[model samples]
Target chain A: MAPKKLGLKQRYAHMTRGLDWETTYQPMDAVFPYDTFEGIKIKDWSAWEDPFRLTMDSYWKFQAEKERKLYAVLDAFAQNNGQTGVSDGRYINVVKLFLTGVSPLEYQAHRGFAFTGRHLRGAGPRIACQMQSLDELRHLQTQIHTISHYNKFFDGIGEFPHMHDRVWYLSVPKSFFDDARAAGPFEFMIAIGFAFEYLLTNLLFVPFMSGAAYNGDMSTVTFGFSAQSDESRHMTLGIEVIKFLLEQHPDNLPIVQKWVDKWFWRGFRVLGLVAMMMDYMLPKKVMSWKEAWEIYFTEAGGSLFQDLERYGLKVPKYADVATEAAEHISHQNWAVFYQYSHAAAFHTWMPDKEHLDWLSEKYPNTFDKYYRPRWEMWAEMEKEGKRFYNPSLPQLCQVCQIPMAYTEPGDPTKIAFRCTEVAGETYHFCSDGCKDIFDAEPEKYIQSWLPVHQIFQGNCGGATVPDVLNWYRMNVGADNMDYVGSPDDRLWSEWHAAKTREAV
Target chain B: MSVTAIVPDYARRIEPRDPVENFHGNMLVYVHWEDHLSFCSAVAFPLPPAIPFGAFVSEVVAPAYAAHPEAASIDWSAVVWMIDGATKVPDMEASLAANGMKHKTLVRFWTPGLSGWKGTAS
Candidate 1:
């Protein structure tokens, strides 16, 4: 008989673990320079245990099949003019925000994991990261294809990659991934692989995908399903990498803990956009941002930390502050967008009376108490032929780079302000979490490219708003400002009216 | 504290990206009208340090808040002035530099009775 076909486990073991070799021409340290410099002493490369075994042959085949299925559905979505099927015109702004603010981040993750795949010493994790890197690249491609249909109709999405590099709000997500990509191999793994992928991925992707489902965007939900398989491998690798690093040496715990804490807060700040999207942008609601945070972070991440407690890792620092923030950040972010909508690539509007009542229902304690007045004021101003737009730029935090819009934890009335004097210069922060992050790494934060600072410095093309918008590649009135008289609103309304006429 | 990096030494010294000198003789002064959340956060203006404090108030700070309904009625004498969280009383005729307001200095002012829109404090 032919030699017994190698079983799946044997093949995976041979294909992956059997690939490493001792170097004689160059020392192992020379070959693997990146893994050691991070101060993480890996005692044994062989000791790493992969939670899932996926060889290149199988990874390609599996991913290729998913891509085929995903493309087929996306093709149908485009052919069928699926944009008209969405809940309302306002819903497209959520997609615009994602395409502009988020899709580029997938590409950044791809680059990050590609760098990580080459740098890690262990063959098991190297193969794992390489596969995840390809998965990220594929995810980017699929996300572009998934949302490309919107670009044909939407104003803001036409220059997503351009905007991702330069837009003020897009910088929030861009700088986040840039921070991870610029970190050491070990820190990159912990910051992105563990904290972002395992702990926070559900919180980020679920809102968009579920929002797609609830609002009748089939292609978005379809790609979400396609990417789910790859995400599983990534999540597993995330946990495994954390476990491996922690178990490698006792010294690794503090370093890993700091990365976890830093990335968690950084990721929390970035997710404020998502909070706004779920709360205000989605015409048909899913769970409230507070409710989603409770389920995903409070309940799920609570268990994850409890499990990680065995390795002397407690929950990330300031998790309670982050939890409390979920109640208010959405409103604060929405308000920021509302006043400064003239500068944003997407449209902004005060919610209608019914929508305001929905907000009061969702955020009973805070809505009527703290946030409604601003919305009502803006609405009333619009009625008086004076739609209010903040003429001046707002101050941005040095660490997370969000506008300093967040209020003090206990006091919803005042914007939380924290600052530190580093060297001869002063840096500002939105909260204690960002302050701690800056204090820990003052050298890194002072180099923040705060958009307002850039504009005032005359570096972002010019001194005037029109000049800056030109440099940002913004289409002026077409792309930026309120939704009421926009081309998108007009088209959506025309289509809506035609459908009504046909029904008649 | 320095950046944690594998290559800590670059070819040249690391410089802060937003030093005051980069702004062409102007400093970014952050002004917050306490309890006013409609502007969302403190707004910053690039102004010359030699500009008169009165001009900085009348030209830059006052107009930024002119959109507020109660703006035309506020008592400038009773407005509490704090710079970087410390209460200060500076001469209106003096320069911002003489008033000790430097680059990135946050100037917080409170209008005694006017809290926010309808006292929602937003």
Candidate 2:
């Protein structure tokens, strides 16, 4: 039977509980105001078209289903010897980073989405934003829940909340959120909605999901992809938000232009970790960071730039810097990851031969020349049962909180450095400008959320890896013992054994 | 919050060549709105003759575009749709290209009084 097509009011009622109180009786009294600012007149706001065919019923049902599926997986993983299934205790570093760096962004998205839900004008849009808000809230919860499973087994997860509050390394994401939260509603849409969602979302989620898949982490991939489905809707919201504002006011152009320029660079800097994870961390590499950026940013961005130029706005400054960063970010960040693993919750295993082969294929220019040799040295150490761990703390960037993986533009080897004095003690930074920024505001600088500092202060996990792992809820696996009898391995063996017995 | 590539096994390199002789630059622009009374961001990409802006936008951009708008107008067939960037879209280039839209003659304008400028007139 063909589905009955109801009128807009009836359909809306079927979708939502019912139309607003006055829909049937009250006469339309210009309840919704049109855009009057800047003197751009729209004779018809009704001309607007909603691309997403979302209704309340479908929204709730799909969301509920997604939750059911996710929890089932989580339950299985935990119940069937999931506790000991890991690559190594070293791999917890990735989760540590995920909890501290990535998970907090989930919370930020939740907050931002809530703001969008409340502020959006039309009912249809309000619904979309509300769905997105719920989606982001779920994402935050699931990411915490899934990774929390590891808190019992790893070190760095315990430090995330405290680190997010006070770690210098965490300030990268924190400041990014702070910038968004401080902006006007429209500006927030541009900064995060358009700039981050449209321009940068692919960079953030792709590598993390692929890394999860490659490392046999089913939960992260499921949750990441599940959340991303909603992100597609959010991306549309971003795109529409920009168009709607521009169409509404001719005066908004320059303000919008500056926002694009500023946010593009800001979001790009924060995504440096993503750049590394894309190019370096995944065991089964799909695309290089440079390639993803070029395809996602350049081909797509170049077209958008031309379109905007027709409208009259400059392509963002530091765009060239972003393109350049993509080229070397993988090698640089992995090096930092290798050095910092001693302090991190995750393990850092030397790149296996298969991983090296993938690197050679992905990074045709630099991997073999510079990073490959370094990995080879680590491989040799691994051969002798030694894992290389950098003894000293890395110089962290003041702005991004990441250890400065940057060198002079084009000089990959020259590490950047800066320093400042606060409370009669010299503080160090990745660049002189950062040092200057710190010196100009020592109070803000001193209040930084540095994970390493907290670790030493005995505020996290009672001064031991196990204690910290418990706090973080991490679980080390069979891979930790060279892939022999960890949960994954045991489960594999058990499943196979059962199958073999059935065969008999 | 999270971005997943829905397309299957899609991968390519972003190779930037040094300035080459006889390079004819073409551009693609896409303007999309996220929600009602929210904001519209434009994405622009500079393409050589090699890339077909229309196909990319229809196949890749439209789905993403539809996802964002409370009410979105999707013109997969309209390759060179001119968006008045000054008035309707801001930072119009990157957002368009991010969604796979493009144009031939790219101009950036910001004032509402400016006549014949597709964006806001200055």
Best by TM-score: 1
**How does each model score on lDDT?**
0.89, 0.56
True contacts kept of 1: 0.76
Q: What shift in Å separates residue B25 of candidate 2 from its native position after superposition?
A: 59
Clashing pairs in 1: none
For candidate 2, write residues A454-495 as lDDT tens digits: 444455575564554344444444212222334433555665
Off by over 4 Å in 1: B8-12
Clashing residue pair totals per candidate (backbone < 3 A): 0, 108
CA RMSD, predictions in order: 1.2, 21.6
User: Which DockQ values do the candidates obtain, in the order shown?
Assistant: 0.73, 0.01
